[model samples]
Target: MDNMFRLMGSEEFSDRRRCIWVNGPVIIGAGPSGLATAACLHEQGVPFVVLERADCIASLWQRRTYDRIKLHLPKNVCQLPKMPFPENYPEYPTKRQFIDYLESYANRFDISPQFNECVQSARYDEVSGLWRIKTTTTSSIAGSEMEYICRWLVVATGENAERVVPEIDGLTTKFEGEVIHSCEYKSGEKYRGKSVLVVGCGNSGMEVSLDLANHNANPSMVVRSSVHVLPREIFGKATFEISMMLMKWLPLWLVDKLLLILAWLILGNLTKYGVKRPNMGPMELKVVTGKTPVLDIGAIEKIKSGDVDVVPGIKRFYRNHVEFVDGQRLNLDAVVLATGYRSNVPSWLQENDLFSKNGFPKSAFPNAWKGKSGLYAAGFTRKGLAGASADAVDIAQDIGNVWREDSKIHKMRSRVVYRRCISLA
Candidate 1:
């Protein structure tokens, strides 16, 4: 208790007369992006602290996955800057292994986080030009609260925390079977011989279906639209390894289109297998609309082999049956919604109108907005989960530049236009 209070509220002076302030200059989540951001800050000798709602870093990955869950991208591309993963691990690290990696990462950087500290509210104080952060410590703290007046706020809380379950009609009154979101999912052992409907075809949904099949569960996947499917490996190398190499040389749009074309050529007429080719241009973070394609998990093979069933989207639900949009009803013993998540930021920041109506922060750059006092948003956009690493690289330089009071920040004030491109087609 005494140490925790001292770390957050008290300060010590360094030899160079550098005032190592106790107040947090940055508060980051303990996820991948958050860890990368903190690592960069530490390297720069920045005074910051990370607040994790869970007992450790990567808690979401620890809690919100079925058994046998593996990383969609390979370790070479997913790793934080300068931290090489262990050679013994597979190309795609499993959930437990990844959690262990995050632990190793924090320890390697000597980032001793204030575990079990969940940030409840974060507000910007205009008069003091700092962010007033409020957080509740875990049971060990006996409900004692802590406050921080930080110079900046980095939201590494990815968009995957709040699950987006479908609003089925009469679900509460009619359905008698168990319904669970992917977040609460742990394993498929209980449904060893029962029938189940796994909704959504994203990475999580496909992975869940695969696990159920392995456990002898008759899992039917419900696909609402089409997805671009790519293999984990091509020509004896991980796909993401190829992607990271290409992303450095080519533009994002060009890379996406080229990859999409390559996937179609390799996979062929995806519609026959319930996968759809997007009618839009290359999938980029800038075009933050509609669903992206799925990474192939051999689940489609399970579907063809009669181990899993592919059905249309859900329209309604009865006691143990789910009706699809095509007027087809199927009997199911359990339902697993693999739908994605949304950002659920606390009210303290939301009340400031810092976020766009779509719930994302309005500006995203060195100077995203005009005349807003010392508030920053990093790791908000998703360009694959490793986007956090990308954000860390950009943000560290940006923040360091800001703290140094560099003249370059003023050069882009009139030239940069951080406007959203509206799609009419």
Candidate 2:
């Protein structure tokens, strides 16, 4: 790889257009997806820069997630491209354990990312056939703007960039109790004897409610619509592992039928507890609508044992009480909006082709990673870490091939970029 700017020393310049040129791709996140891509690229002898908005790698895991959250999937599927989890780790690693694994993986690969540099905007320069990325640093050298010009822009930011907070009627004005998103919530110790309203019945919501119930808090989970709740394990093996095994032999529909049959036999009918299954099978629903099924991990048992209440959607909030869609009203002390997350691509990425208005790639998984003008995505796949790892490997291989071809004739005496652009690690 060639360096466009030879002046590695800090310098000031008024010309903003003349930026530091990255000989390889400029990855957007320092999360698992981004780290995996960087490691794979390193193996291919490619030099790249990773820019993270946060101070540390895996900010979501380190700063945002609750303390009790573990890897929903098995460690085998959650591992990155090149590094495998430690043999001593549990089947489902804890949050801290997963973060530790990512740290070790980064250390093993010597992947140093430019931390606290948040990308403000990234646009493809049609004239230069390169991507121009503008960012602002939040570190001690704060409020300073920096730009990077690179041939490739790998968007490894992943699916959950921003937390989704729904605008419910009277949510802000009428509610007298404390309301916080799931990302902001860590534990239920403070809410020990209080009634907590948990919104959105996704995996996070279910898990959060379970945590609250375990902590001796009254948590009423709201099931707004139909959802698929599957057992985390079928018999003794992991349900996901069984699904993968069956997928290799049987058709998706057939596998779904078998899995549902097993789920029914094990968990019984969920309708009795106010839980409704979606019309589409779990896998089919996930593939068609990107809605993941809830893998039961003691939450359903809590609901069945009357430790956690399963309620309907919220109509509005009235003082310290919530009115459900089914005309049931209950007084609650706090509300935890486990509404999940969305991609921030549409907010900063100044492009229209590769990503849709909703910040997801227009194309589906597998094909969603690569796009025109060297734009790529890593973790947008609804299939979770396993899918993201697949995308990371594919991206590295593609960029490595081009880098190999370019190195054959790349010369040292190349034009240097202007002083305005900073060369980050």
Query: Which numbered prediction scores highest in lDDT against the true structure?
Result: 2
How high is each candidate's TM-score?
0.81, 0.93
- Per-residue error for 65 in candidate 1, Å, reads 1.7
lDDT of 1 by residue, 328-405 (tens): 888889888998888776434634555665556665533332225555555666555556677777666667767555
Q: 1-425 in candidate 2: lDDT tens per residue?
A: 22334223225324645466687899999999899999999999999999999999999999999999999888998899888999999999999899999999999999999999999999986655778898988896446778988889999888899999999988999999999999999999999999999998999999999999999999999998899999999888899999889989998899889989999998999999989988789888887989888999999999999999999888999988999988989998999999999899998999888899999999997899999999999988888889989998999999999988777645322323322233531
- Evaluate all candidate structures by whole-model CA lDDT and list the values in order: 0.71, 0.90
**Model 2 misplacement above 4 A:** 1-13, 16-18, 411-425
Give the TM-score (vs. native) of candidate 1. Answer: 0.81
Q: What are the C-alpha RMSDs, in order, of all predicted structures?
A: 11.4, 5.9
What would the TM-score be for candidate 2 when compared with the true structure? 0.93
Residue range with the least summed lDDT across 10 consecutive positions in model 2: 1-10
